[model samples]
Target: MHPREATAARLLKISAGNAYDPDVDIDWDAPQPPGIMYAPQERLSLFGTPLWDALTPDQRVELSKHEVASIASIGIWFEVLLMRMLLRHVTGLDPRSAHVQYALTEIGDECRHSIMFGRMISAFGAPAYQPAAVHRALGRYLGATAGGIQTFAAALIAEEILDALQREAMADDSLQPLVRMVSRIHVVEEARHIKFARDELARQVAGSSKPRRLYCQIVVARAAYTVTHSLINPQAYAAVGLDPARAGAAAWANPRFRETLRWAGSRVTTYLQELGLVEGPARPVWRAAALL
Candidate 1:
């Protein structure tokens, strides 16, 4: 095998131990709560809108599941990208070959994640797969950009922010056992993924021209803000048979939702702060954007 392929195989072996087969591992018949099952305030606060109050308890449960699944899907996609990038870097292989391999791996991972989430919805008989409009748009925007350092920086921000959520979900005692288990497992692997992204980004940024570096930073920050805002998808309300417009407006106005929004925002803020990107004008932007 090519060295990169060997590396990927090794990583796959490691991941297999952590691989959760939803069909066999997750109990699809678990009892679900009837009311809104809020994630910890910290997790919810990441949004700018008041999603907590706008949602009925049951709706909240459905939205929460969707949120988790969204993150997992993103992770699977990131790995697919990473594996392709690695192949190009290591073996001088055609990018097409790398892309093909990456696509296969991503499809498999996404399928498993979808099944795991689908089973959770089955248990509750609730729809838990609402695609947040903002998220879709932001994803498309990022996809349009040339994939390189800028993409890597955005991925770094995204992974760190998500790691915070996964960590909280794993540790929160109120979560269902299955939910906690999934969160714990995801966080473990994601740590390595985030480190790889950050290190790669640092190297890429350092090697770029100063102008390019600044531009990349600006794009990354803006992308993070846009994606964070998209987290409050109005369509989620509609999935549970609620009026999307009213629920979206109500979610924005609700104090509880605001609180959760702030909580979630802090995770991103904290990550930026650690990276020294939260100073000067960026400070106010972070504060304003982080309403949870």
Candidate 2:
């Protein structure tokens, strides 16, 4: 078996002791009162936007479904990536055992996250959409690459993006308690993952050549774009019985989408700036994307 797969299996074994199955773990009978999960003002970008108000009740429901699926899919991908990293660490290819172990714990946390999300879909009777092809390809490429620092950087970028969304979700007091709980749990664990990723990136970049640094920056930037664009998948809309093409087009064109991207980019840019990774032409692009 591949080294990463082996490591993932071992971690799964250790953490599987108290595994919670979605079928039996969650409170599916929990009450869901009829009201907006989040207030209009709670959504930073969509608040008072003409486009947002134009959405029908069904459309809004579809959008909410998309949001939950997006978060769950990304969470699963990150767990798999963490498993790969653990394999590298165990083989002595990387010396960051503590960080890798912490990430493994997070992976276990995400397993529960996936279950929660899946259960949410089951409760709502919405079909689950798969991740976008582009995003899946990007994740596969990142996972297939062999290098500790590179993997760490990819993971860092991902965690930073997630942190941005979680912050927004947590700030929205109008969100359902169950939704808020999931966001809170994710934010807590991601805080540690982000710290580990940033520290590792800084350590790796400190003595790197100019060319290597530039390469790393490019990789990180590409990963960010890949993730951001993936959020606009049409399948998510279709899964919830909405018109995929029209809804996706409207969603992609919506200013709220841009705002979501900005929210995600800002967190990434902040970390890059703190690490002194921003340089040359790429700095302006990163800044513009964040500040947009």
Candidate 3:
């Protein structure tokens, strides 16, 4: 069998043993802890900024809750987009192949996850925090066209960033109970998905010619920029009573926050480098997004 098929088979075995139903597993009835953060304190965009220092503790917690929920909302949007992309790619494949089967299983997992995120947003009383209107329209166009290694690698950017933040939240004792559960469930399942993406991406890169690799690199960089830049909605600050314009500018330009975003991106960057996807042309795009 091809290495891609072999990797897919291995992932299928893991999925069979570890797949989850968030609806059945999470206890939605428990009272989510109020007066506590919705994510780890440091993961908040303005965490170390002067604006963060100026907020009252109650306001900080409130903003953290909304910010975390907004991120989860973005997760839902990306998950839905990627699932459609995956399904579209596999639709013409041999149904008997492990690659096709694994794609179907991963889509099932994403469906549950998208539902879980929607539930979490409503449970926490957060507004439907979406990306800017422009991004939503762009996502639809990209979802239809991002079909190859670019799709998987771009998906990794979102998954790994969220995984970093969620891992922090899951370990924090003071975050809301609902947040902890969501973090835990997503972290566990995403591990398998990440593995599958990495394996498939490496397989594709190993075989493609220089021109094909270059094409993939450019497209992946653009997609990565779009996904990473859209994660934190500046309006999330306004929702909690801060001046969105000022706060968003501060968060983007803050040294500590830029470092945090870069750190969150480091793992993916290293992998892309190993795959020869982080060439000179792509570096500018990644750096512009503060992801390099």
Candidate 4:
């Protein structure tokens, strides 16, 4: 039996006892706060830039609202991809096994999260912010071929980054109630999923040969770059009355944003390193992505 079977069984028990329904948990009919930011000021990509100083209060709040919506939309996109990878990975497992059951439970949670994100975006009146065409194609490839340590670790990385952001949003009284509620729901559910992925990744790494481990390190690092880069779409800036091209450039070069990426990536990278998935070949990509 795999090393993580016990971990899966325990998580399955926890899920059975405390799963949430976003439809019932989040009051969709509740009034959204008018002209309030959806995230903490410090989490804004251009928070420390001159462009940020030039913006009026209403514009800043609008930016936060759209930015948060884009983040939730991206969460949906990644959830769909991870669900496919998880389902494929568990295809041949025994139907009654805890591992397979927990995988399905994770998928069920993601489905609810996606629906919640969709409703949240609509309620905020933001346009759908999808990944670029090239990124979508790359995601399709990863979802199909990536399994074992690579699949779970990549999902964990994505979840952790969003978790960091949502944790802050959930606690900041300056933000809208709708945003905080959604963030709270996601954070609580995703914590269990993250634990399951981390455990599975460690077990998979322990079983892999050196060459296979190296391959996953490089591939998963590339996937990490894609996920970090795509979290916020450039079009989100246009919604706040800024030129997307100029704002994109400014945000990309912003030291604060780069710092945020590095800080958010550190925990996942450290864990990946411990699992032998952060070797020499992967280091440069991580650096270039500003995640190192």
Q: Which residue pairs in model 3 clash with each other?
A: none
Candidate 4 lDDT over 8-82, as tens digits, reads 888988988987788788888899777788888877888999999999999999999888888888889999999
Error of 4 at 24 (Å): 1.0
For TM-score, the strongest prediction is 4
Expressed as tens digits, the lDDT of each residue in 1-292 for candidate 1 is: 7544454455555566766565666555665444434355435422335445555665556666555544454444444444444433434445454333543453465455545545544554444343355555555556655355655566555556656666887788787666676666556765544554455555565567866655655656665665455555565556666677887676556666556545655654565455555455444545445532
All candidates: TM-score? 0.65, 0.74, 0.95, 0.97
lDDT of 2 by residue, 1-292 (tens): 7444344345445454544454464456877556555222333233245545776765665566556655566556656765675466445434344444555565566567666766665665545556677767767777776355566666766677767777777777776655665566667656655655565567677768888877766666666566555544566655446576776666656676677667676766666767655666555545444332
RMSD after CA superposition, every candidate: 5.8, 6.2, 1.4, 1.3
Candidate 2 Cα deviation (angstroms), residue 288: 9.8
The models' CA-based lDDT, in order, is 0.54, 0.60, 0.84, 0.87
TM-score for candidate 1, please give it: 0.65
Cα lDDT tens digits, model 3, 1-292, are 9877898898899888987687788888888666877877776789888899989988988888888878888999999988977887787899999999998989999999999999989888887778777778767876887766877888788888888888888888887888888899999999988998888778768878899888888888877777777878888898768898898899888878888888888888888888899896988988888887
Q: Which prediction has more favorable TM-score, 1 or 3?
A: 3
Candidate 4 colliding pairs: none
